[model samples]
Target: MNKILIIVFFLSAQLVYAQENLNFGRQKEIISPQTNTDGTFTFRLKAPNAKKVEIQGDFLIAKGTGPAVEQMKLGADSIWAFTSQVLPSELYSYSFIVDGLKIRDPNNVYLIRDVSSVVNVFLAGAGKADLYMVNDVPHGTVAKRWYESAGLKVNRRLTVYTPPGYESSKANYPVLYLLHGVGGDEEAWMQLGRASQILDNLIASGKAKPMIVVMTNGHTSNTAAPGESSKGLYKPIMMTPDVFNGDMETYFKEIIAFTEKNYRVGRNKADRAIAGLSMGGFHSLWISANYPNTFGYVGLFSPAVLPPSNAASPIYKDLDLKLEAQKKNGFKLYWIAIGKTDFLYKNVSDYRKKLDAMNFKYEYRESEGGHTWSNWRDYLSAFAPMLFK
Candidate 1:
């Protein structure tokens, strides 16, 4: 009888201990990101049985070249945790590699998709980075608008950002044609670039004029971004050939015509601006050169102006004639920026030399890091304020 009583007492005590240790309700809090007052961050993942876990993120190092993997430590409650060092004020994306598979943070709900992959996102600080954040400012509206592309013979989509009070006001606003990189589409600026937030905050602060920002899909053959249309069911093709074939120019004209017809925007060159990053930068170059008098303001963020493989290529064939025309037309701002360590640094430098030789008046700005979105976002923040001023 005494043995039975002892066994019962032991089992009850074990049950009570297990219940106390189990994270029944506090699991969410335990695994969620905890921002410390000192500007560091603690990320936790609840994977008890995982043999190995590591955190990889853009913020892990400079140059934004990461999968800067850092091993996570296992805690008492089987939660793996990693604390980041004092990070700078910016938005960051991170994911966990459990065993060998890459996975996003289940605790984090804020995510941004790039190309076809999605990752968890978090903001590290305030103040300078607040432009990228959703502040208590009058926000703009971003809409996915479809238009018939006469050039491609397909219905195309683009993202448009209308400033606050635009719905109620009958004001005719200036337009800014924003372009994305090779793998990006209309949604790139809206999602990754935080175009709406940046424009909203800048306009609220009186830094940037209230203007309509149009983000277009640079892909010539595709109507919209991947998975954004029924056409996306077909295999994606390379846009490089189409770009060189002058299909983009036709697409550009179609988009411009559509914008003029649909939106209450200025018609003249003085009220127009165009800017892009990487391949979009290349598009901006070709587009601005092709229609020299169309845009008053031009910005190229880490433009991919590759050295000509042969003189027969369209990108290099035009030579100085296009730039000369642009110079004659007169531009309000020809802003160009690139990271010092970017892979295309040499290409941009060589192009700048050509510009210098031609006396092509341009504002050059160099930033830190490589071919990454951080510099691209910074470029937009700086470039937007300069427009229509």
Candidate 2:
């Protein structure tokens, strides 16, 4: 009887191993994004019963607009497939619409959450956009840290990226205070912008100086990013009228202090930089102007500058004065970039005209696209290489 029991256990082990091997074989057969040799991509979905299926993605449409829909052909095996044209080399967010309900690619495991929505992601080609892609290079470390905000009366969280060998080396590094736009948190730059990978590749290639990049949550009312607060509430903390008045600029000083005390970063203005996109661009403008001589390098990507209707307001008056003071201080780089067709083009153009009138020394650039992550990522790629030089 003992021999029979041992035989049964041996047979069970064999059965389990065989089952596992079969499952692995099945996994190898699943492919969603099948990249063709000519740079086009074939995305497949196994919705055999769906009457209508379509594909949409960032690569297919302009920024800030709804996805450009492309109908997928139903295959003989009931699988739905769509082959894209030769797309540019870049990371793209996409989804499948089946019978009018949008869904992520089941076979594609990579995903990203923008605001409240989650979408599948894919990388195509190896062009200038390859800087954003992850390569076999020395990688940096990205971490989320909480700091006590005395002004806001809450503990706020920010994402910090330390360059490779930061842990083992005892070197002081310059810090770039990177900010994100509205509806985005500290994670936006790392996720959507792929800032970590960009820095890693640039630093490895000797194109960019290795530095610590601090991504701060710009929303003054919220301690952390959306859905990341300790209070278990997803709703944003609404700022009081007073806080909206000018508290954001003041609150930034605390963030800088916290970063300096906690990290081995330079404390001088020459060792500091500030840049952001959209609302973040606005913050960068406000912070750098209000706090003169704070950052040597300032970047504004598609800045959301409102029309100058209230030239008499104290804020505008203060900005005017601050601009002159900033110019006198002699900054290293004051860079502004906007998409030609962006909705905020007029505002930025008007602000540029004002700066021109003031003789404020700044570099202005215009690209092909509108307000989107693509332009912002490209802006960072261009701007970072010129920092701390």
Which candidate number would show the highest TM-score if scored against the true structure?
1
List candidate 2 segments past 4 Å from native: 1-28, 61-66, 233-245, 307-317
**Per-model C-alpha lDDT, please?**
0.86, 0.86
TM-scores for every candidate against the unseen true structure: 0.90, 0.89
Residue 299 of model 1: what lDDT? 96
Structure candidate 1, residue pairs in collision: none
| lDDT tens per residue, model 1, 264-298 | 99998989999999988988888898788999999
Q: Where does candidate 1 stray beyond 4 Å?
A: 1-23, 62-66, 232-243, 306-316
How far in Å is the alpha carbon of 294 misplaced in model 1? 0.7
Clashing pairs in 2: none
- Candidate 2 all-Cα RMSD: 4.0
